[model samples]
Target: MAIPKYHELRISALRLLSDGRSMKLRDFLEPLANEFKLTDEEINEMYPSGNGHIFYDRISWALSYLNMAGLLDKPARGIYKISKKGVTMFNSETPEYINEFVDKEVAKRDKIKKNKNPEIKIIDLNDRQTPQEGLYTSFNNIRNSIYEEILTTILTKTPAAFEKLVVMLLQKMGYGGEIKNSGVVTKQSNDGGIDGIIKEDILGFGRINIQAKRYRLDIAVGREEIQRFVGALAVAQSNKGVFITTSYFSKGAIEYVENLFGNTTVVLIDGKNLASYIYDYGLGMQVEQTIEIKKMDTDFWDSMANQ
Candidate 1:
């Protein structure tokens, strides 16, 4: 069976977690996988392009999501019990108890947990204008926030969700890219490496091939992976590649790219850089404010003086 969406997986976990018993992520996920009829092979097919532990991270995300949605209260790494919300959610006798409950029933959660009266931020009406520059500033700020969210999401999200986000972002950036289900394995991966591909430009015009490595910590994409990516570029008869990751590259990997820049013009974006770019571009985020500025036409002014 095809990989389930992240939300779907979360809902499944929630329904099971709805029971009074404390459960582990694996406990809820494995049986849910069975109920969903996903074989190990099928399940393995869900990680993002370059990640190896897609399932494990995704399970983590499911648990985190339930906790945020006010359903399950996790006491530790592997243990979870139904919250007041969860227990009530389980008692529903409707056809669509899960999705419906989260949507209409669960109200928007407060950003911060507090029992005191909430303090709202007040903007100076005079300073906060909807002019051109103001608008641009607001828009950029919101976009950056979303990029941060997406990066954070990918850091612990399902491979399926990561892939969807990659596709969406690439498309927004006008990259002629495709997310092939290579089961998140790489040719350089003596164990398992590489992820998705982004063909940004046409062959002659130049193409940007992407290697997105979603990591949890500082893992250097060393000479081996860089070398393999180079080989892949050669196979495709292309000259440019991007090695992106949610971690730092080893010194060897950095030096290797420096050595090869004359040829492939490879670009490396570690997790921090990747997150910043997404923020700057406003991929999955919404625009907040718009601003405009006006200046006199210098040429016209000059002509008037001459006249």
Candidate 2:
């Protein structure tokens, strides 16, 4: 079954705490998984950031929202119990009604804070996405825009520049050891299908051949082109190759590489993936700003309380 939304988990959380038992955040995982009948895979599914399980993150957000709405009480660090308001709301309100109430309550608190501190920005909680989800969505949208810009910029550069860029990207990806001149872009003329090469070691025993294509967005690298590259690898007597393009590969091209039998291994990086790699490796890009998201240290608070 699909994981329940954070708002959907609100009533269930209240129901769990209705008996006046204090529960830790971890205590909710099994009961909530059982309540939703989530499969093992679903329970273990991770957020795109890979920091935590998506299900667990959503449950934490649900509890936080409930606390913000005065529906739950945190009597101790990392511990939660349904308050009188929460029990009353759970018994009397539908899920949708409770969600709307939470939104209104949060907005009211924001209004009160805004009256005291004009610098505090208010958020619109009407959207189904939680604040964290909204932040990630915004981040992805910005990254996609930058990816398009990177492709457009690369398409305008000369073929040699594109080859050099690919070589630099591979080096940034740790293709070569901390040795200078480990990666080299071959000359355009008299060069085989390979555009660049990276020495994987100091002794130049292992190498990764590169074939970079500065193709138009509408063009696709086809099976014939891949076969030609394989033939070129055979001539070079090298089995490892990377074919990067400012376009995509045809289905036949991908299938041909996938079904290849031998020691030869070719990795394909299309325009989208190429741009993503460039971004990830911080090639041809600089950090304009960094935002840090901070959270409460509940364990530290618990330690202080014990003292």
Best by TM-score: 2
Instruction: Quote the positional error of residue 289 for candidate 2 in Å.
Output: 1.0
Which tens-of-lDDT digit does each residue in 1-307 have in candidate 2? 8999988888888889989899999999999999999999999998766667899989998998899899999876579998899989888888889899997897787687568447444544565787777787667756765786699788878999999999999999988979779999998896798899999888887889999999998799999999999999999999999999999999999999999999999999999899999999999899865768988999888778453
Alpha carbon lDDT at 303, candidate 1: 80
Best by lDDT: 2
Each candidate's number of clashing pairs is: 14, 0
The lDDT, on a scale of 0 to 1, for candidate 2 is 0.88
lDDT of 1 by residue, 1-307 (tens): 7666665676667667655778876676578778789788766664443434565566676666567677788565457887987777667544266665554322343233112114322223367566665656555544444544566666767654654555455555656644333122233433222345554444435455656777764456778888898887777676877777777788898898888745677888876677776666786556544434578999888888453
Q: Which residue pairs in model 2 clash with each other?
A: none
- Model 1 scores a C-alpha lDDT of 0.62
